[model samples]
Target: MIEENSLHPETLAITSGRPRNTPDGSINSTISLSSTFHAGGVVGYGRYGNETWTDLESAIAALEGGPTLAFSSGMAAISAVFSILPVGAVVTASNQGYSGVMTLLHTLQASGKIEVRSVDVSNSDEVLAVLPGTALLWLESPTNPTLAIADLPRLISAAKDAGCGVAVDNTFATPLGQKPLVMGADIVVHSVTKYLAGHSDVILGSVTTKDPALFSRLEDARKIGGAIPGPFEAWLALRGIRTFPIRFEKAQANALEIASRLSRHPKVDQVFYSGLASDKFHERASSFMAGFGAVLSFTLHSGVAEAEKVCESSKIITHATSLGGVESLWERRRKWSGESQLVSETLIRLSLGCENVEDLWSDIEQALGNA
Candidate 1:
C-alpha cells in the first residue's frame, strides 16, 4: 500500500481506487450486484458490504486521510454520527447551516435523545462558552446560505480541550479545499451527492475519520440500520470522483470571478463569498482553506420578490435547491419553509459549474436586469 502522504491530492484522486491493470483485468472497478458472497469472506452479506462501495469508500478515505463509511444519502451519514452519541448527549451546533441537519437536531431534541444548543459558530468566544458540557461540537465553516465562516482550528482545539468530539460538515469546503482531520477534527462528513459525485447523477453521503473505533461504530450502524448505498450509486460516485479535482478547480475559478462581479452590480446589496476582499470572512477563509469554494450567496437591493425573480429569470442557470453540480444552479434559499428564519428572505445562493465565465456572468446580468 502506498503511504497516504506520499502522493499529492490530485494524484490520489486519479489513482486511489483503480482495479489492477493486469493483461486481462479490468482498468475500472466493476459493480458487484450479488447480495451474498460464498462461505467465509469479510463480506458475508450484501447489506454488510459490496465491492463497489469499498472502491468508493477507499477513494473518499484517501482524499480525507482516514477510513470512511458510505451511506444511502447525506442525511443517513449524518444520522449515523448521531446514532453513536450517548443517550441524552449535549450537542453544540451551528445556528445556521443546512436546513436538513438543523431539522434533524430539532427532532432529536424534541424526542429527548439529545439536548441541542445552537450558537453563532463564527463567534469563537460564543461557541467556546457552550463547549464545557457539549458531547459533540458540530460545525460548518462557510456555513450554508449565509456563507458564514468559523475559525475551525481554534474551535476544534477548544472542543477537544473541553472533552467534546468535533465533527465538521465539510460539504461546502470539500477535501480539495481543506482536510479537517489534519486540523484535529475528530470526524468529517460530506454530502457526496454534491461535489464528490460532480455530475449530480447520484445521491450518496460519506463519513470519514482517523479513529478506528468511530469507524467501527459507524460500520455497525450502517449494517443494523440498513442505510447502505446501492452498488450502482456507489459505482457512479466513484466514477465522478475520478474527475473531481479538475471539475472543482474550474468551478472554483468561475465562482471567484462571479463573486467579484456580483459585488459591484447595481442591484446587489451584499455578496457572501470569502473570495471577495470586502467579505467579512475573506481573511479567515483564506487562512483556513485552499480555495474560496464554488458556491456563493448574495442579496439584491430589493426584497424576497426580486430574489425570486432573479432565480426564475435565469436561462443558463437552473433554478434548483441542491448545489455542486456541473450545470450551474441557483435559488432563493428562504423559499423553502424549512430554511432558517435567521437567513434573509432575499438571499440567493448560486452554485457555480464548469461553464464559461462570460456565459455565467451574462446570464446573471440578464437575470438581475429582468428581476
Candidate 2:
C-alpha cells in the first residue's frame, strides 16, 4: 500500500481512496446503485452505507488529514453539528460568515435551543473576549461575499485554552488552499457543492475531524437525521476532487488578474480579494493559505442599478447565484433575501473559473463599461 501521508496533497487528490485494479482489471470504481445489500453484510442498506460514499469520504479525509462524513448538503452538515450541542449551549460565530449559516443560527437562537453570539472573526481580541462563555467558536476565514480574513492560529489557541470546541467553515478556502485541522481547529466543514465538486453539477457537504469522539457524535447525528448524500453525487464529487488541485490553480490565477484589474477600474470602489496586495486580508491570507482562492468581491461607485446592469452586461461571465463552476459566475449578492446586511447593495461577488484570463477580462471590461 502507498503511504498517502508522505505524498503531497496534489498527488493525494488523484491517488487517495482509489482502488487497485479489480479482477476484471477495471481502473474506475463503478457507482454502487443498489439501495439494499445482501443480508448479514457490512453494508445492509444504502441509507446507512455505500461503497461510493465510502470512497468519497476517504478521499476527503485524506485531503483534510482526518476522518470525514458526507451529507445531503452543506447546510445539513452544519445543522448536524449544531444538533449535537446541548440545549442552550453558547456558540460564537462570524458576523460576516455565510448567510445560510447565520440564518440557521438565528432560527435556533429564536427558539431558545442555543445561545448565539455574533462576533467579528477578523478581530482576534473580540473572538477571545467571548471565548470564556462560548461552548463552540465557529470560524469562516475570508468570509463569504466580503472576504474578511480571520486569524485562525490565535483564535484557535484561545478557544482551546478556554475549553471551547472550534469549527471552521473551510468552504471558501478549499482543503488545497488551507488546512484548518493543521491550524488546530477541532473540526473543518466544507460545502463540497462549491469548489470541491468544481463543476457545480452536484450538491454535497462534508465535515472532517481528528477527534474520534467528535467524529462519532457527528456520524450519529448524520445517521439519525438521515441527511446522507446520493451515491451519484458522491461519485461525481470524487471525480471532481481528482482534478481539484489543477482546477484551483487556474481559478486562483484568473481571480488575481481580475481583482487587480477591478481595483484600478474607474467604476470600481473597492475589490475584496486577499490576493491583492492592497486588500486588508492579504497579509493574513498570505501567512496561512497556499493560494488566495478563486472568489473575489468588489463594489461599484454607483448603487444597485449600476451593479445590476453590470451583472446583466456580462457576455462571457454568467450572472448567477451559486459559484465554483467551470464557467465564470458573478452576481449582486444583495439580491438574495438571505444575504447579510453587511454586504453592500452595490457589491458584486465573482467566482473565477478556468476560462482564459484575457477573455474573462474582456467580459468584465464590457460589464464595467455599462456600470
lDDT of 1 by residue, 1-371 (tens): 97767987888888877777899899898998999999877889999999899999999999999999999999999999998999899989988889999999999999999999999999999999999999999998779989898999899998998889999999988998988999999999999999999888899999999998998999999999999999999999999998888999999999999999999999999999998999999999998799989999998899888899999999999999898989999999998888999998899999999999999999999999997
Among the numbered candidates, top lDDT falls to 1
Alpha carbon lDDT at 5, candidate 1: 76
lDDT of 2 by residue, 242-281 (tens): 9988998899899999999999999999999999999888
Which pairs, if any, clash in model 1? none
Itemize residue pairs with steric clashes in candidate 2. Answer: none
lDDT of each: 0.93, 0.91
Error of 2 at 18 (Å): 1.7
